[model samples]
Target: MKAKFLLPILIAALALGAVQAWAQAAVGAPAPSFTLTDTKGAAHALADFAGKPVVLEWTNPECPFVKKHYGAKNMQALQAKYVAQGAVWLSVCSSAPGKQGHYPADEWNRILAEQGSAATALLLDPDGQVGLAYGAKTTPHLFVIDAAGTLVYDGAIDDNPSTDSADIPGARAYVAEALDAVLAGAPVPVAQTKPYGCSVKY
Candidate 1:
């Protein structure tokens, strides 16, 4: 009986440790490399984009915080601008199947088309491995990896952090600022910030 009880406790502790281990990606350091499949079932690896700046956007289409940016075209505009300059913008959804924000591939493709999304790919993270590894806590948690593969920025997209589209007009777009500074050979003014939005449904 004692051995049986100890086994359960040990399992729980190991699980917690695994989560902590996966969340070690830090700013100014090499971002964790990952391989995830896009909606079309094509696998892409972070290492494949080496020598180019990359943006990892954690998104939940049904989240109001995400809607605030997309509805205002702020996110797409950012994607378009940076991608035009050779940056790879990846939109990742960590919602598990049967969850609130989860959608099938057909629905995901349709949603992208309907929303005029400009992301290079819609990565499906149904198991949430990518999100957990990045320590993404919010629906719109954003990360920017420079050409050197260093995570130059990680956090909220903007300072407003509200679910209102009107807030975009005056908010400090952190992701854009980071991208500009990194691309210009300057250090990012803000390397990290507490992200705000709906919790990523793992």
Candidate 2:
């Protein structure tokens, strides 16, 4: 009888944990606040970007899905376009220490330069705390925060989930749409979608 009772209790606890995890950075909710160091050693906080649109990009330099965008210059173009329009684009690396994408600041700086990244900052989260808080599940996952700090969008970069750069031309660019809507003070047509890519190396 004790074993049966304990099993149910354990199962309920697990279910509750799952729900809590899923709730982080939920769409329409206030994006979770965090401060992280950039490749240049400058720290950035969500609050600092208040009154401006913010884009949080979960990234792994070694991920093929990420490579698909970078290699094709699609991601850089998006960064340049939005950054030019006054949006703050933050590319975050959540890969843990010793992981495939984890790199020291100097190396990260080199990599970003080599890739021609145009992000406002490349924040590092090697311990994965920020990633967990945002429930980031994939290297290429993306989230958009409106000026009001609400999480307006979360999911894959585009409608196409494949690793083919050719697919990008035909796929709907979800992040761009979200940024446009936010900048225009309009509602996001699609707020959320299933994210695809290599699992975040936590």
Candidate 3:
């Protein structure tokens, strides 16, 4: 009887730990502010981008899901288009040190250069603090903040979350649609959707 009672207690404790491990911010709330070092060692504060639109993308270089967007130049095209429209796109990697996608400043620079990415900064979140605070779920998880620092949109990059490049053309492109709405001073039709991709290796 003692063993049976102990089992239920242990299971409850484990469940609590799981919930704590999956910390994330809520939608329709002010985005959590953070200061992280960019690839060049420059400090970037989330609040600094106040009064301007900002895009926060959680990324993992080795994730095949991320490769799907970069390999097809879909992510870069979005960055280029939005940056031109006065948006600051910050790609953040929260992979821990020695992890599959973790990289130091120099390696990050080379990777970005080779990929021809257009993000304003490649923010490093080696400790996973920022990722957890934002509740980033997967590589390519996207968040859009308005000029007022309110989280306007958060979810998958597009409707299709598969690894096949062929799906790109048919995908609904959620991020693109949200951005277009924001640029036009309209509310995002889909504020949040179930994000699907490789789990962020934190």
- Per-model RMSD to reference: 4.9, 5.5, 6.1
Prediction 3 TM-score vs. true: 0.89
lDDT of each residue in 1-202, candidate 1, tens digit only: 1222533554676777843333668998999999989988899999999999999999999999999999999999999999999999999998878887799888999999998999999899888777877888898999999999999999999999789999998999899999999889899999999899999988
Q: Give TM per candidate.
A: 0.90, 0.92, 0.89
Candidate 1 or 3, higher lDDT? 1
Best by lDDT: 2
lDDT of each: 0.89, 0.91, 0.86
**CA deviation > 4 Å runs, candidate 2:** 1-18
Give a tens-digit lDDT track for model 3, residues 136-170.
88998999988878888989999997998789999
Q: After best superposition, candidate 2 residue 65: deviation in angstroms?
A: 0.1
Name the regions of candidate 3 deviating beyond 4 angstroms: 1-24
> Candidate 2 on 30-147: residue-level lDDT in tens?
9999999999999999999999999999999899999999999999999999999999999999887888899999999999999999999999988777887787999799999999
Candidate 1 pairs with clashing backbones = none
**What is the model-wide C-alpha lDDT for candidate 1?**
0.89
- Name model 1 segments beyond 4 Å from true: 1-22
| Cα-based lDDT at residue 24, candidate 1 | 61
Worst 10 residues of 1 by lDDT: 1-10
Superposed Cα RMSD, model 3: 6.1
